[model samples]
Target: MTLTKQHVRDVVDIYIRAWTKQDPDLILSIFTEDATYHERVLGEPIATHGGIRDYWQSKVVESQANIECELLSLYVDGETAIVEWEARFDDLVRGIRKRMREVALLEFDGALIRSLREYWASETIG
Candidate 1:
């Protein structure tokens, strides 16, 4: 299956919307039952369930204010989508606000995502 621009937009919107304290179940339903996601900037031996939940929970807890992520670019081919994005938050590592660029590769089985691998820059500046 291939993703169209609408599909990419929908996926991005779903993620951003989930960040706004929406129903966690709605967000969880967007992915496949066995979906796998990795945050290359941190963690190891993590998959879905605890891994993904911990990642997002930590982000919200770390930020002093609202954490925001925006879509910069998105490209899809075959069953995979590559998303280039930016996010702003009170850095949990540094305890200050900064922006960082993240690039992610997402694979979908039809409309439901199956796997996501995201990479972020190690060095972030204000």
Candidate 2:
């Protein structure tokens, strides 16, 4: 099936909402059970729903606060969507505030993301 722009936007909206609210479950809800999530270009992809949940719990729920995310751009074709976004948050582990620019490539299986690859750069802003 062809991917629609609004469908991609809806998924992205949930993504931003999940991060802003620090809701791991909400984020997890968007992926398939066997989803693979590559948080960085060189990092190993986290496979399976359990792994994804663990990553989000530690990375977002435990280690970040005051999160905000903005969608900079989005493009969708076929079953894939590419999204660019910026985020600002406090890193509890590092005790610093950070701003990040990221681009993610998402491949969908039905309505859920089956695989996600992300590339990003971040700076300590506070």
Candidate 1: count of backbone clashes, pairs at least 3 residues apart or interchain: 0
* Each prediction's whole-model lDDT (CA): 0.72, 0.94
Worst 10 residues of 1 by lDDT: 57-66
Query: lDDT tens string, model 2, 5-119?
Result: 8988999999999999988899999999999999976878999989999999999999999999999999988899999999999999999999999999999998999999999
By summed lDDT, the worst window of 10 consecutive residues in model 2 runs over 1-10
Q: What is candidate 1's lDDT per residue for 1-126, written digit by digit as tens?
A: 567878977987897677645335556666776778776636552467565666566655444345677899998888888999887666656667777789988888889888888888744446
TM-score, predicted candidate 1 vs. hidden true structure: 0.78
The top-ranked prediction according to TM-score is 2
Top-scoring candidate (lDDT)? 2
Model 1, global lDDT: 0.72
Off by over 4 Å in 1: 20-26, 41-45, 61-64, 122-126
